[model samples]
Target chain A: MLDEIDRQLLQSYQRDFPLVHDPFGEIGRCLGIEEDEVITRYQRLKDDGYISRIGPLLNHTKVGVSTLAAISVPAAMIDSTAGMINSYEEVNHNYLREHHYNFWFVVAAKDNERVDAVIQEIERKSGTDALVLPMVKSFYIDLGFKLWQSTQAD
Target chain B: MVTDQDIIRIMQAGLPLCPEPYASIAASLELDEAELLRRIDAMLRQGTIRRIGLVPNHYRIGYRYNAMTVWALDEDRIDAVGELFGAQASVSHCYKRPSYPPGWPYNLFAMVHGRGLDEINDKIAALKKLIGDDCRQSDVLFSEKILKKTGIRLKNRSSEHA
Candidate 1:
């Protein structure tokens, strides 16, 4: 469980990590804690697997590409396929879902062509045909969530 | 350097869907568009602006079929295991989460989206062939509804929105 100060820290920093040279210093000033404490706690959170990363979330469209991919792995082979998929730097995330297309992941690249090429490589290597679904239009949403501060309203 | 006020303005205005959005933003700020572009380019290079793109309202967009997939594998093979799913294009996000309690079989998490259930099923089949027999249990956490989706403006002064 997180205390009020911890919650506040997450609310402030989760989605938008400050861009300054010394972000911990800026965050420390806000929390009235030492910069080193901020860094230590954050590192602790990551080490414990509470937060996956502490960095910028780039705009893929601006870079000219992004893809939302999914596959149906047999109840048996998920381990091997996940290992193969996550190894590629182009593949940022891989998830196993409840639906028939249980294996899903996202691939962001420099453009649509590159994104397609990466998908093809996966198909060739894994011998699985991955369905490519890129974002056509987004009405509203942000993927970032605050697990540390659950008391805050979503 | 960007101030809290600047962050507010950028988040509130949203990214312009124009050919030259940074230039358009600069026009409003009364700064040279070229200089503004240079700053934005630098910020991106430095990992300041994580992403500038559409926030998918999957429900509103009729993409009701979405799920969080999880896999449990021996610690030794995690990296090799995760890479298989990550390479696919359908997956939007993936990571290694802690294993579920005794009743659950999911250890690795990935977010996959589809137009409907049928399409999602077909994709899952192909994945099974790829991973082999050590998959353990794969569970799907379908999203029932969207709670909220808004970018965080790191330096903003107001907490009222929170």
Candidate 2:
């Protein structure tokens, strides 16, 4: 159960966090709280797993290349196939989904060639044909969750 | 122009959680605090960095039911349908991808998160009503497990392609 302050912090700081010498101090000013309190709350949120991290969400398209890849693996071979795919540093997001092409992962690399190379390597090692689905157009992309609303039904 | 490598190295590790976070990072990179800020500002303007802030773990925050819903729509209506799905508050990511005929026929993908499958299904029903007959078929692929999740890391300059 989160208090109003925790909810406020989670909601307000999801994007456009102050870029200042003392950002927490700035946040403290905004919320009419002390700087130390802001830091403590942030630490608590992270410790409690409510928040993953405080950082920049880099645009891989500008910094590197990436693709969403999927492959169909038998139930008996799911574990081993996932292991093989996860071995690549380029593979950032790996998930098991309820579909024929169950194993899905996102691979990011410095360039397209490298992205394809990593995909090929994964396919070779896993012995599963992988479908590479790069985003043709992104209609929307925002990861922020409304914690205030999320906790309301409870 | 400052290279992407410099920015990636600083950002991949994550922004420091301190009173003077950017200043601390600038000192290590031997960059003036103002210049570092300016570079980051430029990146923001250019869409290199999507956002700089706290990212919550939705699962931990009670959004346990996560599903990647894919829709097969009439090719001509993709942009319109994409806009409709993308505008929903529950939809986090919406994109257009190529559809492999016969086996894979979903072109528009949207990820919806909620407290339970019922909540997500409600959203899907709303989507179905909005899309009408334009949506040929759709399926929800619920995530069973997360094997890995990490920020992208760049290779050394020597190995980087020109």
Candidate 3:
């Protein structure tokens, strides 16, 4: 369960986290709390798995390339197939879905060729044809959640 | 102008979590703090860096039901429909992707999250009604398990390009 301060921190700092020196201190100043207390609370949030990390969300397309790839694997083969795909470090997000194309994953690489290569590799290893869907255009991205609303409701 | 690769190399792993994070990063890259901030500001302005902040774990915060809902719409209607879905607060990622006919027919993809499946289904129904005849068919691909999730890491750029 998150307190009001934690909810406020999550909501306010989703973006534009202080870039200056003593960022925690800066945040403390804003929240009317001590720097040490802020750090402690942040650490607790992270430890409790509420916060993944305090860092930059890199724009992958600006720096590299990425594609959403999905493969239809038989129920019996799902576990082994997912394990094989997950072995590749480039495959960052792998999820089991409800469609015929049961396994889906996103591969982020340095270039288009590498992205294709990963798709091919996964197809060969999984023994299933994979559909590689690269984003033609992004209408919207970076969907950060509103934690405050959930906290308030609770 | 600083090369994007240089900026990526410096900031790929993320800014250090400490006092003077930018100062340390600038020092490592042999750049003045002001110059580093200037480049970052420029990137933000140019849409290179979408955002810089703490990414919350939605699952931990009660948004456990998530789905990547894909819709098959006329190519002409994609932009308009995409814009509509994109504008919604529930839709996180909306994009136009190539649709392979007969097997995979979804061209417009939108990801939505909720506290439960009922909520997700409600959002999907709302989107479906909004799309009406523009959408021929649609499917919700609920995320059953997260195998791996991590920020991008630019592998040895020189080697890759070379």
Query: Which structure among the candidates has the greatest DockQ?
Result: 2
The local distance difference test score of each candidate is 0.57, 0.83, 0.82
TM-score (all chains, Cα) for each model: 0.47, 0.92, 0.88
- Interface RMSD of structure candidate 2 (Å): 1.4
RMSD of each: 16.9, 2.7, 3.0
Stretch of 10 with least lDDT, candidate 1 chain A: A139-148
Q: What is the lDDT for A10 in model 2?
A: 85
Tell me how each candidate scores on DockQ against the true complex: 0.05, 0.75, 0.64
How does model 3 score on DockQ? Answer: 0.64
- Residues A47-148 of candidate 1 have per-residue lDDT tens digits of 454443443354555534666676766868777777877776567657665566666677766567867888898888777777666654332234343222
lDDT of 3 by residue, B1-162 (tens): 556567766776655655577888888878888888888787877777777777789999899888999999988999999999998878888999999997888999999999988988998899888878998988889988887777676665665645
Compose the digit string of candidate 2's lDDT tens values, residues A1-154.
7787888788888888888778899999988899999988998888899888887788878877899999988899988887888888789899999999899899998779989999998888778788889999988846465555554311
CA shift at A3, candidate 3, in angstroms? 1.0
Candidate of highest TM-score: 2
Better of 1 and 2 by lDDT: 2
True contacts kept of 1: 0.08
After superposition, candidate 1 runs with Cα above 4 Å error: A19-22, A34-36, A125-128, A143-154, B1-48, B51-162
lDDT, candidate 3, at B51: 75
Q: Is the docking of candidate 2 incorrect, acceptable, medium or high quality?
A: medium
